[model samples]
Target: MRAAVVTVGDELLSGDTVDTNASWLCNRLDERGVSVERITTVPDRIADIARVINEYRAEYDAVLVTGGVGPTHDDMTMDGVATAFGREVVHSEAAEEWLVEHTDYAAADLTEGTTHLPAGARMLPNPEGVAPGAALDRVYVLPGVPGEMKAMFEEVAEEFEGDHTHVEVVRTAEPESALIDRIETVREEFDVTVGSYPGDDVRLKLTAGDPETAAAAAAWLRERVDPA
Candidate 1:
């Protein structure tokens, strides 16, 4: 399955907050055998959020939107999604119940704006926070906070599951440039992705559908790298 991740926050765009959500979500999605084609960091603007979500949902099997779902004024992820799909943002009973039962907040604390979800969206409970994750068709809306987002995503991980991929990393002391040709050759020969990283030790990553194919590709590239 192919997916796209959209992170929405003015802080992320201003460099005030690090966008660890995209990387974390990407890794988790990969573990479920879902390939992420794009990782977009967008502002909290409703129009932009809706536009990206609309485009990505049309292109990928699933679209994960992180950030902008909180009590703050800029928390507009839910609204953006509702507008994008031309659905009304309605009160989420599941969200309200989860919040009131677990949190110290009272009924008055749970306003429509804070607990609203896209009409007909499947609610994904937030184990760690008040703003629950929601699924509107192929679009998944998650919280901006790292802890809450991770907890919420775990609840819906199965939705994105697919055939697992086999991956291997071949480490060497040789320079990155030295391994590019061999990496490309092995990639073409085995139909796997070969990644070259420059560092104290160059790293080659091989990924394919099965273990045997990935291992064979790793071995092919490893044979050419100089030993540390």
Candidate 2:
């Protein structure tokens, strides 16, 4: 499946908070065989969030949005999603119940500050935090907290399972520039995506959707590269 990941927060944009959510989600999506088409980090503005979500939901098979659904004033993910879908933000009774049952919140006076979600949105339980995530249409609104986002996503990770990917890696003492031509040649000869990087050791990586293709490409590249 092809997907887009949206991370929402002013902190993320300003570098006050590192966007671990996007990378973490991308890695998890890759492991599940889903190709992430794009990763966006938007300020906590409702307009930006709404715009990105609307665009991505149409272009991708699935959209995973994380961040901004907190108790604070800047948290605007739920509102943005509701605006994108032309839906009204209503108090989520189910969400209140989950929080009241699992958290220290009071049932008699359950406030709907951050608990207000798009009407008819499916509440995905958050065993890690107060506000639960929501699934409106093909978009998922998850929390910004890394631990919480992780917990919420694991609950529905199966939905993203896709084509099995295969990877092969080899390193050499030679620099990346020395291998550029051969890497390009290998890519032209194979169905895999070849990548080269210069580090302590120059690293060559081959990735393909099919295992046999990846293995063959790796073997071909291996024969060309001088051993470290």
Best by lDDT: 2
> Model 2: per-residue lDDT, tens digit, 1-228?
899999998888789988889999999999999999899999999999999999999899999999998667888999899999999888888888888888887866654475778899999989887878999878998998899999999999988878878999977788887887888888899998977777788888899978899999989987888777
lDDT of 2: 0.88
Give, for candidate 2, the lowest lDDT window spanning 10 residues.
107-116
How would you encode candidate 1's per-residue C-alpha lDDT over 108-205 as one tens digit per residue?
Answer: 96755777888999887888877777998899999988999998888888889877899999899988776767877897899687777778887787
Candidate 1 wrong stretches, greater than 4 Å: none
Q: lDDT of each model, Cα atoms only?
A: 0.87, 0.88
Model 2, which residues run further than 4 Å from truth? 109-111
TM-score of each: 0.93, 0.93
